[model samples]
Target: MLINKAHQALTDDVVKENFLKYGNPDGPSDVKHGIALPKFLIDGPSSPFLVVIYILMIAVILPIFVNSWWDGVKSYTKLGLHVDTTTYFLEYLLNYNPAELITIEKIIGFLSHAKEFKLYKRSLTPEIVQKLLLSHINRTQLSPSEEQLKLQVVAIAPKLIIGFLDLAATFRNNEVCFQLVETHRCLIQALNPEANATVNKYKEILQLPGASLEKLDTTQPIYTLGKLLKKPTIDPSKFLNIENTKEVLDVAAQIPLIEPLDCKFTVPGESYVPPASTSHVDLRFIVKSPAQKSKPDVSKLSKEVIETQLKDPETLDYLRNPLKVVEDQPKMPLYSVPPYFPDVDYVRQHSGWVAFLILQKDGGKLADVPNYITRVDLSNLKLSPAEFLESKAIVSAYKFPLSTPTPNVGTYHFRFVLRHLLYFGSDLDIPFVMNIENKPVETKRDLYEIEDPDEDSIAGAFAQMRGESVKKFEHEYESSDDEDADDDEEEEESDWSDIDTDTEDESDEKK
Candidate 1:
C-alpha cells in the first residue's frame, strides 16, 4: 500500500514537477526557528504551573501601574507644584500680617518647611526646622547640628527657587516668576551674616558684585542702583577695590531704570471721550540705561525739543503700537556661577516686568489681571557708559484698555505700577486720572417754528408774498370769530333775562 501511494504521488503533475526539480515527491518543507522547550514544560504539569505564574505577575504589576498613575494625579497641581508644597506655602502666606515686618530669616524659615526639601535630604523634618526657627527668633545661637541643617537648606534653596522659576516660565506665570526671582536674590543676600540685616535687605546693592555691607555703608548711603549711579563724586572704587568696582559698575550698567516722560488716559482717535465710551491708558517712558560710574546730567534737549520729539511720527507710531513683539527668549543664565549657587542642572533667567493698574480708592487692589512686559530693548547695554546715557531714550509705552466703559462722567484715580520681574526697588508707580466728558444736550426746534428768510433772496421774496397773504387771511378769520363770540354772549344774556321774568310772574300768581 505504501508503494502504491508513492507511485500515485509521483503520477500527479504538480508533485512530479516538484520531484523532478528537487528530487523529492513533496514540496520543500518550511524551516521555522523557535526555542526548543522540554516536553514537561510544554505538555506536562509544569505548563499549568507556568500559566498560574503569568497570571500572578500580571495581577501584581497592574495594581502597581494603576497606583502610580493615581499618585501622579494626586501629587501635582495646575501650577505643576506638589499639592502639599502649595498648601504649605498658601497657609504660611495667608497667616502673614502686613503690619509685621518680613525679614530674611522669616522668609528662610518659611521656605525650609517646603516638602521638596525632603526629596533632597531625608533627615530634614518639621520638628528640626521649627526648632531652628525658634532658636533664631529667640536670638539664640544654632547648635552645630542645627547649623549644618541650616547650611543644607540654604544650599538647596537656589535649586528650589530655580525649580519654581522653571514651572512659572512653563506656565507663563509672570507674577510667580518675578516673586521667585526676588526670593532667589534674597537667598543669596542672606548668606552674608556679616552684613547688617538692613543692608542685606537692600537687594539692589547686594545684587552688585563685591558690594559688601562696609562698602555700601559709606557716608552717602547707597541702597539703590540709581543712588549708586547718581553719586559719582562718591566714587565706588574708593570703597570697593579697583577690580571689584569694575565688576559692580559693569553689572550696574546692564540694569535698566525707567524714567517716565508722560502719561495720558484717552481714546485712540477721538480728542474727547463721551459718556459711556472705551479708553486706554497711554504710558510713555524712557528706559534710562545705567552708566558705569555715574549717569550724565538730564538730556541737553530743552522742553520744546522733548515735546517736539514726543509728537514725532515715530513716537506716534510707538504710541499706536504700544506693545513690542519679541521673539521667544531662552532661559537666562545665573549672573553668579557655582559656589554661589549649587551645581544644579537648571538655567535661571529674568522673565520681565509685571505691569498692572490699581484703583487708588480700592485700597490699592489690582484693577485687572497683570500684563507681562518681556520686550524691553536692552541693546543699548552694549554701548559705552557715556554713549548709553546720551543715546536717544528707548521710548517704550504701556497701554491698559479699560475693560468696562465709564458710564458716569468724572475723573477716575488709578496708580499704574510697573514692577520689575528680577529686582526689587525698580518699580514705577505713577498716579493718573481718566476723565469722561458729559454728552452735549441738543435743543430741538418745534416743526411749526420757522426762521424768517433773507429779504433780498428769492426764497425770502416768495416767503414775503406768502406771509402777506397769510396775515390778511388770519385778520379776516379772527374778526369773524370775534363777531360770532359777541352774538352768542348777547343771546345767552337775553335768555337768562326771560327766565328771571317767568320766575317773577309765577311768584305773583302764587301771592
Candidate 2:
C-alpha cells in the first residue's frame, strides 16, 4: 500500500526538485517546466523516513565505525551518489538524528500536495523502455546487477511496448498519448534497478534516437498536465491544484496502469548468474610482511618478522579449512572485484598487509577478525611493536557451502591477490584487493592499422621473446594455404555425394 501511495506521490513539486538537484537542479531559473514526477520521488521530501535518513546521514552516520555497508561517504562523496536511497537507509541505522528543521507534516504535505511525479515503469511498451535505457546508458552508475537488468528489460521491452499499444487506443489526442507511449522505454529503464545503465543508455540514445515518452497514446487529457508535471522546476502551489490534479489522477488511473517490473532475469547491479547457488569455498591468500625483515633470505624468515602469527581461533580455523585448488586452465571467467579501497591513496607507500578471508557455509561469522585490533601498525607503516597485527573483525561476506565435495582445495579460481592496506593515518581497516585472475586476456589487441615500422618493431620483439625463426611466418602461411586448398577439394568431393541418383550411382561405382 505504501509503495502504491508512494507511487501516487510522484508530483510536479518533487519532479522539479529532482531534475534540479539530480539532472541539473542549478540550471537556468527560467525553463521551469518539464516532467515533475522524478523530482517528487527525489527532492519533494515525501519520504519522511528517507528525508530523516538524509539529514541523519549528514549528521550522525559520518561518525559511525562501520566502513563498508553503503561504502563510506568518502569515495561516494566524489561520485555524488549519496543523493539516492541506499545510503539514506544506512544513515538511519548508524546515526539517529533527533532534531529536525523540517517538520514531518511539512515533508509529507510537500509530497502529498506536489503534482504527480512520473515513474517510467515497464509498461507493455518495452521498445520505448529500451530506447530510453540505451539513451541514458552513458550517465547512470548501475551496479553489476543493474547491467543484467538492462539486458533483461531490453529483451522484455517488446512485450511492454505492445501493452502500451493497447492503451494507445483509448486517447483522443493520439499524438500526445502516442508521444508519451514512445518514451515508455526510457521511463521503464529509469525505473530499472540498473540506474547507472539507464542513465548512460539514456545519454547514448538522447544523442540519436531522441525518443521520449511524449510520443505515446493515452486515455486522458493527462498529457497537457503531464507537460506541466514534467517541468524541471515549479512552485508547490502550481502543482497543488487539487481539482485539476485529481482530474489528471483519474485519467491516469483509467489508463492501463504501469507497475514496477521486477527483474526476474537477475538482481539489478552485479550479474551473479551462479550455477545453482551451489556453495563453494572462496579463499584469498595475502602474504603478510613482517614487522622487520633483516634481508632477502630465501632459506629463513628475517628476525624482525613477528613469528607469532595471530593464533586466534578465527585465524587458525581459516587456515585449517581445507582449500581445494581448482584446476587452472587458459580460459578465465569474468569476475567482478568490489571497490575495496578508494583510489585516492598514495599506493606505492601503502603497506603490504593482506588478508586471507574465508567465507564459511551457512552464513554466520563469515569474517573471523574482531572489529578493532591493536593492529594499527599492521595497517599503517608505523610499528612500535605494540600496534602489531591483531585479530580485528571482518565485515560480512558471502558464505560458502557447509561441506564441499572436493578435496583439500587451494585457490583454483584466482592466480594471485595483490593487495595493499590503506592507512588513513592510524586506520588499518581498508584494504585494496586486486587480482590477476589467471593471465592477461588480450595478447594481440591492437595489431591492425599499426605502421609497418611499428609493426616490424613489435614483430621483432615477438621474435626475440619467442625465439622463433623469421621464416616460420612464411612456412605457416604456405602451410595454411595448402590446408585450405585441400579442404576445398574435400568439400567438393562431399558435395558430389549429396547429389541425387547420379551421385548415388557414382558412390556405388566408387565403392
Candidate 3:
C-alpha cells in the first residue's frame, strides 16, 4: 500500500509542485484528482444503441428498480418484527466507494507479506476485544438497538484488565509495567458501569467505606488517555464547595433566631395633622411586648387565652411581630364639602389602608365618625408562613367598585376603622379630616438598592459607566507570548546560521 502511494505521488507533478510551494499539497492548491474514463470509452468508436442502452439503464432503469425495492423494504421494516437483510446488504454494497476495488490487490499482497513477519498470530484476544468493543460503545453514536447489542457484548466479555495484568506479569518485577496495569484497572473501574458497581459492592462487602470510583482523578495523564477511549468519570464534588465545620457554623450564626410575639400599640408620631390629601397617613409607633426568657410554645396552647403573663418588666418579650387586621370592615360614610365625586379614580386616589374601601354614609354623628372601628379585612392577602415572617403585611390595592350616588356633590365623611390582628387586642383609633377634594396621590415606593443614589455615588457611577473600557487590575505575569515568539524566532535564526556554517565547512572539505 505504501509503495503504491509513493509511486503514484512521484508520478504526479502537481502534488510535488504544491508541496514545494505551500509545504502542504492539500492546502488550497485547487488541483482536482479523479479516476480517468475507461480506455475503451475514450479510444474506441462510439455505438449509438449501446450508448443509449447504457445511459438509460444506469440513470433511469437502475434508480427505478432500486427505489421500488427500497420502498417495499422500508414499509415492511416499520413493522419491526421483520426486515429484509438482502435489501439492506444490497444497499450497503451499492453505496460503498468504487475506490475500495483499487485497494484489493495491495491488501492481498500486504497480507501475504505480513505472514513472513508473523503478523497472523497478532489477533486480538477476548480481553482485548472486549476493551475495544466497550470503548467503541462509550464513544460512538449508536441507535437504541445497536446500543443494547453493545451493552450485551460488554456484559458477556471477560475482564479486560486481567489481560493487562497477565501482560505485566510477563515483565516480572518491572515497577513501571505493574504501575501501568494498576492505572488501567482504576480507569476500567471508573469507565465501565458494571465494573464500577461490582467494585462498589465488593468494597461494601469488605466494609471499605467511601471507596468510590467517581472520586478517581480522571484528569491525571494515565486516566485521561484511558478516558479518550471510554466514558469519563467526572467528579461532581470538584465543582461543589465543601464547607468545613467552622465555616458552616459561621454561616448558621447569620440567620435570625428570635421568636416573634404579638405587640401593643404606642402613641403615633406625625409631622402634620391630616397630612396632604394625596399622602397616606403612616401611623408609625413602636410596640412593647412582655420580656420572656424564651418564646412560649403556641402549638399546644389554646386559641382562647394567653397561657401565661409576665409579672416582671425585665422578663418581657423583645421580638415584635407586625400587627395585622383579622377581618373585613363595613363600608363607611364619606361626607365632603366639594360633593364627594363617587368616582372610581377619586376613591382609589383618596383611599387609605387599601385592603378596606370607603363607602358613603347616610346618617352618623360627626364625633362618632372619628372613633368608628371594625375588623380589618385580610382575605385578599395570600402568604406562606416563611414569606409572611420575612416580608411586611400590607395590602396595596382593593378592587371594590365605588358606586355613584344620586346626589352630584355634597359635604361627606367616610368613617374609617382599625382592628388588631389578635383576638385579645383592642381596636385602635386614628385621627383624620373630612370633606377633602380629590387629588393625584404620588405613590411612595421604596428605592431598590441598584437605584439608590448613595449606592451609585460619583466614584461608583464612573466605575459602572466605563464598563469593559475600564482597565482591570491583574496580577503581573512573567514571560508573555511576545517574548516566547521572539525567542522562537531567534532559535530558528541560530539553527539556520549553524546549518549554513556546517554546509560551508563541508564544501571546503570536499574541495
Candidate 4:
C-alpha cells in the first residue's frame, strides 16, 4: 500500500502543479490554518450538534446584530441630530407664541436644549445650561464658570442652526428654514457682549464695523445699514475714530444692496397667462455697492454703455438663461469676517442672498421654496469711490418656476423676500401682483358663405331634407292666401251686378 500511494502522489497532475507553484506535494498547505476538530465533533454522531449551532446563529446572533443596526438608525435624524434633540426643538417652537417678541435672550435660552452641549465633556448638563441661560435672560449675575458656559452655548447655537438649516432645506421646509436663518443672525448679534442696549434693540446697524449705539441712536433714527449709508454727507469720522474711519469706509463700501428693477409673474415668450397655464416668477435686479453713501444711479451710466451691456443680445441671453454665468468677483476679505464667534470655520460668512416668495393672502406664508443668489459680481467694490458709484450696474436675474398651474382667472398678491445671509438690514421685501387672464373667445364664420336660404333654392331643399324650415317662407305663404281670398270676393260682386241688369231688360220687353 505505501508503494502504491507513493506512485500515485508522484504521478498526479494536482500534486505536480502544487510542487511547481508552492514546492509542496500534498497540495500546498494553507499559510494560516484553523485548529483541527476533535474526532467526535467531526464524526457522523455530531450532525445534530452542528444543526443546533447553525440554529443558534440564525435565530439569536443574527437578530441581535440586526436590532443593533436598527436602533442606531432610529437614534439620529436626517439632519444628523439626535432624535431627542429634534423633538426638544420642535416642542419648544410649537408652543412659542408669534405675537411675543423674539429677543436674543429668549432665543439663546431656547438653544440650550441642544444635545451637543453634553458633548463638551465638562460638568455642564442640559439642565445646568438651561438654568444659566435663564439667569442670563433675567439679567442676573453669573459666576465665571456659568459665564463661560453661557458664551460657549451661545457660540454653539448658530452652528447648530446651520445644521438645522441643512435639514430644513433637505425637506424643502421653507418657512422653518427662513426662521432658522433669522435665528442664526440673532445669535450672531448676541455674541457681542459690549454692545449697548440700543445696539441690541437695533442689531442691523452692527453690520458696519465702527457703528455703535452712541453714534447710531442719535437724533436721526438710523437703525438699518441702508439708512446709515444713505444718510446725506455720511461722515464716518463722526461715528468712528479718525484712525479707524478709512477701514470702516472700505468695509462699508463692499456691502451689497439689491435694487429691484422689475418683478413680474408671467409665462415666458407669451404676453399673458391663460387660465390653468404654467407660469414662473421673473425677478430682475441690480447689485449696487453703496460706496458713496447712496444707491447706485443707473442714469449715471452713459447711454452707450447701457445699450451695450444691458440691451445687447448676448447680455439679454445671459440674463434670460436659467443657468447664469457671469465674471467672478473677488472673494470677501478676511478682515471683514465677524470676530465674535469662537471659530471662524464654524461661522464662515457667505456672500449670498436667499430669495423667498410669500403669499400675502395666506398671512404671508411662503409660496415657494427659497433660492440662493451667489453669482453676483462684486468687482465694483474694487473700484475707486467715484468710479464705483458711476460704474455699470451688476444686473442679476432669478426665475422661480411655479409647480402648479393658475387655475383661477384673478390677481394674486405675493411678496418677494431677499434675505442676506450675513447682514441683517440688507434684506429686501418687494410686493407684486400676478394677473391670470381668461382665454380668448373664438369668432367662427360660416364655412360655405351661403346667403339666407331662399325657399325655392337648393339650400332650402337641403334644409327640408334635414327636417328644418325657414321662418321667412312661412310668412310669405300666409300673405299669398290673404290676397287670393280678396280677389275672389270682388269677382262674386261683379257677377251679381250683371244678373240684375239682364233681369231689368227682360221686364221692359214684356211691357
Candidate 5:
C-alpha cells in the first residue's frame, strides 16, 4: 500500500517528463527529470524505448568504425581498393589479361602450366580442379551484388572480367597472373618489334643485374691524383740532402674554378674513432710565412741556375708547390696546399687541427658567404642533407673519443667534414630524358659514373681519387723533421681558406 502511494505520488506531468527524459533519454531534460526521483529514475529498470534508441545509435556508428578499420587492413588488397585515382596501375598490371579468370580457369591454367611434369606430380582431376576453383573463387570472381548490379556493363564488355582477374591477381601476388605477362608480351611484340626490343633491354637489365650494377666502375678510373693536385712526387732523398733530380712542375698554366668524412678522434684520455662527415666553403689561404719558398729568393744562383742546379726532379717539384697562387679575379690560380702553416698542435687544443683546416670559413676570409660544411656528432648530421646544411644549422659540433699513436695523455681529436653544396639556379630539375640525335641516351648504370668525383680543383681531385695510390707512407713511419708541416702525417684534412698561401711555408704560420 505504501509503495502504491509512493508510486502514485509521482505526478503525470513528471512521469511524462521522466519517460521522455530518463527512460527515453532523448536529451538533457531526460536525464534531469528521469534521474530516479528518489530511487533510480529507472523505476524498475528503465523503459525499453530509450534502450532500443541507444542500441540503434550504436549499431549505426559501429559499422563506420569497423569499415574504416577493415579498409586499413585491406589497404594493399588491389581489387578491394582500386577505384581509379591511383597512378601506379601502369606498371603494376603484371599483364593485361589475367590467367585465373574463373576458379576452373585457374585450375586449367595450373594444370596446363606443367604438361611436361614428372610422373610424381599431382595429376589434374575435374572434381579437384572444381574444388580448387571454388576455393579461390573469391579471388577471381566479382562480389555477387556488384555483378548483379553491374552485370549489364560486364556483359556488354567481356574484357571487364579479364580486368577483374588481373586486379585480383595483382592483389594476391603483387603481380598480374602468368596469363597477363604472356598476353602483354605477345601484344607488345605484335605492336612494334623495335619498340619492344628497346623496352625488353631495360627489363632484361632489371631482371638480371638486380643490384650488382652499382658495383662496376664505368668512368675513367682516376688512378693518379698526381695530375690533379700538381704536387710533384715527393722523394725522401731530396729532403735529407741526398742525390736528387729536378722534376717537372705539375702546375696547370691556368687556374680552374673548383668548388668543393672520416674520424679518428683522440679525446684527452681516450681512444680515437670516427664517423663520416661533409663540409664546404671557400678557403682563403693567406701566405703568412716570410720564408715562403714562392718569395723571390735573394741568392745569386738566379732562376735558371736554381732550376738547372737541382739535379733531381723531386727537388724542382718542391719549388713548384709552395708557389704563390695568382688570384686575379674570375681567373685566379689556386695553390696545392696552404703556405706559412701553423703547428697543428697550436690549434688542436683550442679547436681540433682537422676542424681548423677544413672549417676556418666562419670567422676568417669568405666570412660573409654562409658556410655549409659542418661536423656531425650523431652522424644524423651527415646523413640528413637538408637539416644538416640548413641556414638554421650554420655550424654544429659534438665530442667523441679518439685514438692516436702518440703517448700524450691530453690528446683530443674530432673529424669535421664540409659539404660542397652546389647552387646553380633558383630551381633544380632531375633530368627526365636527355635526348640526343632524336634518341634517348639510355644511361649506362656503372658505379664509377654514378660516383662522379669532384673535378673543380685538380689537386683536391687527385688527392681524393688516388689517396692510396702509391702507399706513400708506411705504417708508423715517423717524420724526420718536425717542421715538415705534417706531409707524412696522413693529410689531417683539406681546406679552402688557405688557397692564397704556399705549401712549404704553411708550417710556420700556425705558431
Candidate 6:
C-alpha cells in the first residue's frame, strides 16, 4: 500500500508536467486516479521476509540501472543521436515509412564500417559517411512512389552528407582522414548521373596497391618527375667524318719535329798518334740520333745511300779486286800466314758507315757545312748511310795505312752526312777529329772540363750546319788535331772557372 501511494505520487508529478507519452500529450496515461499501481511498483508479497528480500533486490539493481542509463545517454549524445530511445524503436517497429527506414539503414551502414570508426568506436570516415548518405538520393529513379517521397532526401543529401563528413573528420582528428573528407566533398559535388559512381571511384582508389594509393593525396599534384625530362636528340652530322679535324689535331700533336742526331768518335778522343813500328792504324766511329721524344714514321722521314770517300786517293784503290792475277807479280814470294784483306764489295754490302776519308785538309765540308778536318793519311775505310737511318747509330772499324814508316803528328778529321727527306733536304753533319803522334798520347785533361755535357748545344751546333744537299750520303773514319787546340782552350777555361769559384769561397771562409 505504501509502494502504491509512492508510485501514484510520482506518476501525478510526471502528468502535471504534460510530458508527451507515446508521441502525444493526451495519450492514455499508465497511471489513473483510482487504478491499482502495477506489480513492479506495489504487488510485492506481504510477508515481512519476502518484502525485505524485494527491497534488497531493488537496492542492488536500481543503482546499476541508473548507471547504465546515464552511460547510454552519454553515448547517444556523443554519437549525435537526437531521438529518444523509446521513440526510435517504436517508429522503426510500427509506424516507420520507407524514407525514414532508409535513413536508419544509412546510419547502420555508417556504423558497419568498423575500420573507419575504430578510434572513435562510433565514428565514420567522411568518405564512408558521404557514401552512406548519397546512396539513397542517387538510387535508380525507376520507382515513382519511392522517388516522389524521397525527393527531399535527395535534395538535402548533399548538404547533409558534407556536414556529416565534416563532423566525422573533426571527431577523428586525423589529417589523412580530413584530406579524404575534402576529396570526397569534391567528388560528391562533381557527381553526376549517379552518386554511386563517384563512391565507387573513391573506393577503387583506396583499394589500389600501396604504390598507387600514395597518389591519392590531393595535396600533391598528379605528375611524374621522369615525365618532365625529355630525351635529348643526337645529331648525326657531328660524327659524319671518320677522319675529322679533331683526329688531324691529335695526329699533329704526336709527330715529332725533325732534329739533329748526336755523334761522337769511338776510337780516338782528341788525338791518336800511330806508332812508327805499326804499318796500319784502326779507326772506329759512332753516330746516334737524339733520344726520341716521339716516335714518327721512319719510312716517311728518311732515305738512305752508301758511299766510301778518302782524302788520300793514292793510298789504295778500294774498287780493285784482291784476287786479280797480275802478270808482273807472278813470281811474288809466298807468305806463311794469309793476310785478311777485306772484300770491299762484301763490306759495302754490310757496312752502314756514311763516309770514308783519309784527312788531307785542315777544314772541309761534311754534309755541306764548315768543319775542321783531321790531318792524318788514311786508306781502305768503308761507310754506309743505312746505319744512321735504321739504328740511329754507326759504329765501324777501319784499317788505314801509314804511307810513311813514321806517321805525321797532325790533326785529322772525317765527315758523315744524314739527309732528312721529311725536312726537305735538311742535312746533319757529324764531324770528328784525331791527332797522329810519334809518342803515346797522354790522357787529355781538357776532355773533363765541361761539367755537364749539353746535348741540346750539340744539336743546336748541328742545326746551324743545315743546308740543301743532294750529295749521295757518305760515312768516314778520320783523325784530327785541327779542332783539338780550340776545344782544349775552351775546356781549360771552363775548368779554371769552376776551380776559381771554389778557391775564392775557401779564401773568403779563411779570411
**By lDDT, who's the top model here?**
4
Which of the two candidates, 1 or 5, achieves a greater lDDT against the reference? 1
lDDT of 5 by residue, 261-376 (tens): 11222212112212221112112211111111121222432455334321112444433431111111122112221111122221122111111111132322111111111222
The candidate scoring highest on TM-score is: 4
Q: Write the per-residue lDDT of candidate 2 for residues 45-150, one digit (tens) a residue.
A: 5766666777787677875646555455543333222223224322332342325432222212222221111122334243443343553332344567655455
How do the predictions measure up, each by TM-score?
0.56, 0.16, 0.15, 0.59, 0.16, 0.16
Task: Show model 6 residue runs off by greater than 4 Å.
Answer: 1-45, 49-53, 76-135, 139-511
Off by over 4 Å in 5: 1-46, 52-178, 181-511
Top-down lDDT ranking: 4, 1, 6, 3, 2, 5
Position 495, candidate 5: lDDT: 44
lDDT by residue for model 3 (50-169), tens: 567778988999999999898767644322212332243223334544345322122112212221112213453434333435453233346776555444433222122223223323
TM-score for candidate 5? 0.16
The local distance difference test score of each candidate is 0.59, 0.30, 0.32, 0.63, 0.28, 0.33
> How high is the lDDT of residue 448 in model 2?
80
Q: Summarize candidate 4's per-residue lDDT along 1-511 as a digit string, tens digits.
A: 6666467657988766776787656666768853255656657777678768867988999999999999889977776777777777676555655567654454455567677777664666767876765554333568887777677776666666766655555444455667667766655543233235565545655556556554553544655555555562356466443457677666665677777766887664456777787777767666665644454566776777556444324455543652333323333333365534444654445446777877888456677666656656555456555665665445555667777777698888988888876666668899999888886777577798555576767888888778776435555345577677876887787888888888988998888
Q: Write the per-residue lDDT of candidate 1 for residues 411-445, one digit (tens) a residue.
A: 77888877765555667879987777875767688
Candidate with more favorable, higher TM-score: 1 or 5? 1
Taking the tens digit of each residue's C-alpha lDDT, what string does model 6 give over 370-466?
A: 1111221111011122433443432222334333444366666654433221111113344556555555546575855534322346544454456
Against the true structure, candidate 3 reaches a TM-score of 0.15
Query: TM-score: which is higher, 2 or 4?
Result: 4
